[model samples]
Target: MMRSLLDHLLIVPIVLPLVVGGAMLLLGERRTRLKAGINVAATAALLATAVALLRRVNAGGVEVAVYLPANWPPPFGIALAADRLSAAMLVLTSIMALCSLVFAIARWHRAGVHFHPLFQFQLMGLNGAFLTADLFNLFVFFEVLLAASYGLLLHGSGPDRVKAGLHYIVVNLVGSSLFLIGVSMIYGVSGSLNMADVALRIAQMRDGEHLLLQAGAAILGVAFLLKAGAWPLNFWLPPAYAAASPPAAALFSVMTKMGIYVILRLSLLLFGDDAGASAGFGSHWLLLIGLITLSFGALGMLAAQNLPRLVGFSAIVSSGTLLAAAGFRSPAVTAGALFYLVNSTLALGAFYLLLELIERSRSYGADLLALTREAFGLDRLQVDDDDDADTGDAGVAIPAAMAFLGLAFVACALLLTGLPPMSGFVAKFVLLSSVLNPGGLTPDVGSGVPASAWVMTGLVIGSGLTGLIALARMGVRTFWAPSGRAVPRLRVIEVLPITALLALCVALTFQAGPAMRYFEAAAAALHAPHDYIRGVMAARQVGATAGVLP
Candidate 1:
C-alpha cells in the first residue's frame, strides 16, 4: 500500500494545480486573499512534491518511474513518467512558479480577474508537459499552458500589451496547428502516440515509411523551434515579453525553455544514434540555426534601448546556446547546457522583475524632460548637467537600499553575460571546455574537436562579450547617469524573490561540482534511453500481473 501511494505522487504535480485552479475559479475574484492563500499552499506543495520526486529518481538510479492513469497499459491509456531529466525540470518549474506567484502578490495579481486561477493552470500545464510520456498529452499540455499565457499576457491591459498579446496569440495558434498536423502524420504512420512505442515503430519502419516519418518529424521540429524562439521564428518573442507584466514576464522566461526541453527529449529519444539512418538527422540544421539565433540575440541586445526588450533578447541567446549544445549530441556538452539553462533562466527571470521596479523608480518627468530637450535641439550633455545640478540634497542617503539594488543589478548582469564568479561563467566554461576537449587529460588527437565545436566556442565567447557590453551600457544609464530620479521603494515581497533567485545562481556557482555531476548523469540517461523504455514497459507488466490493468 505504501509503495502504491508513493508511486501515485508522480501525478500530484499535475492534478493538484488543476483542482486548485478550478476551485479558485469558483471562488470568484473578490476573495483575493483566500485565493492567494490557496495558490501559496498549492505551489508550496508542488515544490515539495517536485523535490521528493527528484530525490526518488536520484536514489533509484537511471530507472524511470511510470504512472499509468486508470491502471491502463500504454499505447492505450495515458502515461506519466519521471526520470532524472523530467524531475529536474519539474523542480525548476516549481521554483519559478513559486517565486513568480509570490512576486505577483505584490500588485500584478490584482490587476486582472482570475489571475490566481490562470497562474495555477499555467503551473498545471508546465508540470504536465514535463511529466507526460506521450506526444498527444504533450500537445494537450502545450495548449493548456498557451491558453493560460494568453490570459496572463494581457493581465494588465495597455495598448502595447494588447497588441503584443494578439501577435503572440496568432503565432502560437499557427504553431498549434502545425503541432496537430505533425502529430496526426506521426500517428497515421506509426499508429502509436506513446513516445517509446513510436520510437520502436520508427526504428522498424520501411524505406517508404521513412519519408513520411521524416516529413512529420520535420514539421514537428518546426513547431518546437518556433516555441524555442529559434532565429527566424522568434521575432515575436521580444516585443511580447517586453510588454508583459513583470511577473508574467518572469514566468514567460521558462516558457521558451519548455520548447527547448521538448526538442531535446524528442531529438535524443526518437532520432538518436540507435535509430539507423536517422541518427544525427537534424543535427547540422540545429547547430546552424542555433548559431544564427545566437548572432541575432547578440545584435538585438546591442540595439535594445529598453531594459525589458534586452532581457527578451537574452532569452533568445539562452535558447540558441541550448539548441547548439544539444545538437552536439555529446553527454558532457548536454550536461553543461542543462546547467546553463537553469542559471540563465533564473537570472533572466529575476532581471525582468528588477527591470519593472527600476522603471517604476524613474520619475515621469524624466521622459518629458528628454522629449523637451530633443524637440528644442538641446545638447544631451547640458541636460545631464542640469539633472545632476539638483542632486546635492535630494533626501537622506539611503545608501543601503541603493547599494542593495545596485549590487543585485550587477549580479544579474554578471550572470546574464557569463562573467566570472557566477554560475553563468561556470556553465559556459564547462560547455566550452567539454566541446573543445571531450577527453580531459588524453585528448582525442585523432579526430580533434569538430569545426562546429570551434565555431560554437567562438559564438559563445562573442555573445557573452556582446551581452556584457550591452548590459554595462544599460547599467550605467540606469544606475550611474544622473537621472535625478528617486530610488524605487522596494517591497519585501518583490525584493525577496529577486534576491532569492540571484542567491540560487550564486549557490549553483559554488556547488557546480555536484550540480554538474547530476546534469551529466541525466544527460547520460537521456542518451541511452533504453532504461526509459524498459522502465515504462516494466510498469505495464506489473499492472498486468496484479490484474489492475486490462
Candidate 2:
C-alpha cells in the first residue's frame, strides 16, 4: 500500500489545488473565512506532499518516477515525471505558494471576490507546469497559469494595476501566440510532442530535418525569453511586478522562474550534447541575453526608488543569472546554478513579502515627502556608523515592530548583495567556482576556463557590488533617514511568513553541502538524461489492461 501510494504522489500537487479551487467557486464571497481556511489547508497539504516527492526523488534509487494519470503509455498519454529537477521545482513552488497564500490571508485576500479560487488555480498551473512530461500539457499549463495571473494581477483593481495589468496581458497574449506557433512547428518537425520522444527522435533525425527543428526551437525560445523578462522585451516585467499586491508579487518571482525552468528543461533534454547537429543550440543567445539583462537589472535597481520596483529588478537579475549558468552547459556549473536558483527565489519572495510590512511606515505619501526634502537639500545627513544612526541619539527606544522590519530588511540586503554568511554568498561562490573549474574542484592551468566564464565571473561579482550599493543606500534611507516614521502595524501572521521564508534561506547556508550534492546529481542527470527518456518512454499504467510493454 505504501509503495502504491508513493508511486502516485506526482498527481497530488496538481490535483489537490485544482479540486479545492473549483470547490471555492461554489462558495460565495460572504464565506470568506471558509474560503480562506480551505485555500490555506490545501496549500499546506500541497507543500507537504511536494516535500515528500522531493525526498523520494532524492533517494538515488529513483532515477525518474513516472506517473500516468490515464491508462496509457508515454507519447500517447499524459505523463507526470518526478526527477530531482522537477521535484525541487515542485517543492519551491509549493513553498512560495503557501507563504504567499498565508500572507494574503491577513489582508490581500479581501481585495477581490475570486482571489481565493484564482490563487489555488495558479498553484495548480505552476505544479502542473513543473511535472508534465510533454509539450502539449506544458502549453496547457502555461495557459492555465497565465490566465489565472491575468485575474490575480488586477485583483486589487487600482489605477496602477489596471494600467500595468493591461500591458502584462497584451505581452503575454503575444507570447502565447508565439508559443502555439512554436509548438505546431516542433510537432510538425518531430511528429511527437512528448519531450523525451522528441529528443530521442532528434538524436536520430536526418540532416534535412535539423534546420526545421532548430527554427522551431528558436521561436519557442523567444516566447520563453519574453516571459522570463530578458532585455529588450523586459520593460513590462518591473512595472507589472511592482504594481501587483505583495503576495501576488512574491508569487510572480517564481512565475518568472517558470519561464527559465522550461528553457533549462528543453535546452538540456532536447538539445544537450546528445542532439547531433543541434547540440548546444541557442546557448550563445542565452549567455548573451543573460549578461545584457543582468546589467539592465543592476541599472534598474540603481534607479528604482520604490521598494517593489527594486525587488522586481532583482527578480530579473535572478532570471539572468540562471540563464547564463544554463548557457555554460557544464554539469558542475549547472549544479551550482540550481542551488543558487533556489536561494535567490526564496530571498526574492521573502523580500517582496517584507516590502508590504515595511511600507506601512511610509504611509500618506511619506516617501514623496522624503524625496522632496532631499530635492531641497533638507534630507538628514547620511548615517555611516551605528552610533551615528539617523533614527536616534542613544536615548530613543525602537519599537519591536520597527526592529523586526529593520532586521528583515538587513537580511534581504545581505542575501541580495551576496554578502558573507548568507546563502546568497554561498550560492555565488559555488556557482563561480564551478564555472572556473567546469569539470571538477581543481582547475587545469593548460586549459583554463572559457573567456565567457571569466566575463560571467566578473559580472557576478560586479552585480553583487551593484546590489550592495543600491540595497544599502535604500536600506539606510528607509531605516535610518526616515527618523520619525511610524512603527508599522504588523500582525504575527504577516511577520511569521517573512521570518519563515528568511529562515529557510539561513538553513540553506548551513546545509549547503547536501544541497550542492543533490544539485550536482541533478545536473549530471540533465546533461546525460538517458534515465529521463527511459522513464518517460517506458512508463506503464498502474494496474492497466493494455498491450504497452517496456
Candidate 3:
C-alpha cells in the first residue's frame, strides 16, 4: 500500500498545482499573498517529490504508477508512468515554475492581476505533459498549457505582445489540430493509446503493417517538430517568445523542451530499433535535420540585434544540439541530451529574466548606431530654430542592475558555448565520449561505430563554432561592450528569482555525478522499454491468475 502511495507521486506533481491554482482563482483575485504562499508551497513539495523519485529510480530503474480509471485494466484505462527521465523533467518544470512565479510576484501585484492562478495552471499542464501515459491525455495536458500560455503571453495589452500572441495562438492551434489528427490515425491503427501497449503492438506488426505505422509516426513527428521549432516550421517562435512578458518568456522556454521530450520518447521507443534496421528512416535523417536546425538557428542568432530576440534564437540552437544527440540514439547520447536540456532550460530562463531588466533600463532597442557627424573635439552644436529639441536627459542609471545583467549574460554565453564548469560542457563531453568510445555497448547489426563517431564529432565541432560566433556577437554587445547606456534597475522580486536560478545552474554543474546518474538511469530505462511494459503487464497477469485461482 505504501509502495502504491509512492507510485502516485508521478501524478501528484501535476494535480497539486491544478488544485492550488483552482483554489487561488476562486479567492476572487484579492488574496495575492495567500495565492503566493500556496503556489510556492506546492512547487516546493513538487520539487521534493521529483528529486525523491529521480533518486529512487536511479538506484533501481524506471518507476511505474498505474492509475486505473475506476480500477480498470490498461488499453481501456489511463495510467501515469514516471521513470528517472519523467521525474527529472518534473523537477525542471517545478524549478522553472517556482522561479518564474517568484519573479512575477511584483509584476502581478502592481498589475493587480491573479498571476499565480494562471502560472500554476501552466505548471499543471507542463507536469501533466511530462507524466501522461496516454496520447489523448497528452493532448489534454498540452491544451491546458497552451490556453494558459496564450493568456500569459498577451497579459499586457502592449502592441508587440498582442501581435506576438496572435501568431503564437494561430500556430499552436494548427499544431494542436495536426497532433490530434496524428493521434486519431495512431488509434485507428493500434487500437490502444497507451505508450507501452503501442510499443508492444508495433513490435509485433508485420512488415506491411509497419508502413502504416511509419506514416503515423511521421505525422506525429511533424506535429512535435512544429512545437520544437524544427528548421522549417519554427518561424513564429522567435517573435512570439521575444515579445512575451519576461516571466512568461521564461516559462515559454520549457514549452519547446516538452516538444523535444515527446519526440525523443516516441522516436526511441517506437522507431529506434526497427526503423534503424529495416526502413532507412533512421538516426541518419534526424542527424542531418538537427545539423540544419543548428546552422539555421546560429544564423538567426547572428542576425538578431535585440537581446530578447537573440535569446529566442539561441533556444533554437540548443534544441538543435539536443536533437542531434537524439539522432545518435546511443545511451551516452541520451544521457547527454537530458543533461543539456536541463542546462539550457535553466540558463535560458535566467537569461530571459535578465533581458527584461536590460531592455527596461537601456530603452528596449538601443543598438550601436553609426556615429553620425563626427565633429572636432571642440565642436558644439548651436541650437537653430529648425533644430530638433533633443536634450541631455540621458536615462535612469542602476549600476547594481547592470552588474547583475552582465553576470546573467556571461552565464548564458557559457551555457550556449558549452563552456567548462557548466552542465552544457559536461553534456557535450558525455555525448562525445559515448559516440567516440561506445566501450562495451553492442552496436546494432550493420551500424558502423565509425560512422556514428564521425557524425557525433561533426555535431560537436559545429556546436563549438556556432557557439563561438553567437557568443562573440550577442554576449559582447549585451554585457562586455563599454557602452554608457543606462540599463534598468533590478526589482527586488525579479533579482531574487534570477539569483535563485543562477545558483541552481551553478549547483547542477558542481553535482554532475548525481545528475548524470539520474540521466543514465532514465536513458537506460528509455533504451529498454520492455522493462516498462513488463513491469505493468506482469503485475496485471499475476492479478488475473490470483483472481482465477481464488
Ten contiguous residues with the weakest lDDT in model 1? 373-382
Predicted candidate 1 versus true structure: per-residue lDDT over 23-88, tens digit per residue: 999997789999999999999999999999999999855458888876776667788999989999
Q: How does each model score on lDDT?
A: 0.85, 0.86, 0.73
Per TM-score, the best of the predicted structures is: 2
lDDT of model number 1 = 0.85
- Give the clashing residue pairs of candidate 2, or none: none
The superposed Cα distance between candidate 2 and the true structure at residue 535, in angstroms, equals 0.4
RMSD of 1: 4.9
Write model 2 residue lDDT over 189-253, tens digit each, in one string: 99999999899899888887988999999988999999888988899998898778889988988
Cα lDDT of candidate 2 equals 0.86
Mind sharing the TM-score for model 1?
Answer: 0.93
lDDT of 3 by residue, 1-550 (tens): 1236765666677778888888888886667778788878888898898887767666654465444433446656676777677778888887887788788775543343667777888888988888877889999999999988988887655567778789989988998888888888878877789877777777567776677777777777787888888888889988988877778889889989999999888877766464433333446767777777877787887678777777888888888777777887778778877888998899889888777565554422342111001111112222243223333486434356667777777777777778777666876777677766564345555555677568557766675666668667766666667444544545688888888887887888889898887778788878776666655443342134311111
User: How well does candidate 3 score on lDDT at residue 79?
Assistant: 67
Q: All candidates' TM-scores? A: 0.93, 0.94, 0.86
Minimal lDDT window, size 10, model 2: 371-380
Candidate 2 residue runs with Cα over 4 Å from true position: 1-3, 366-394, 544-550
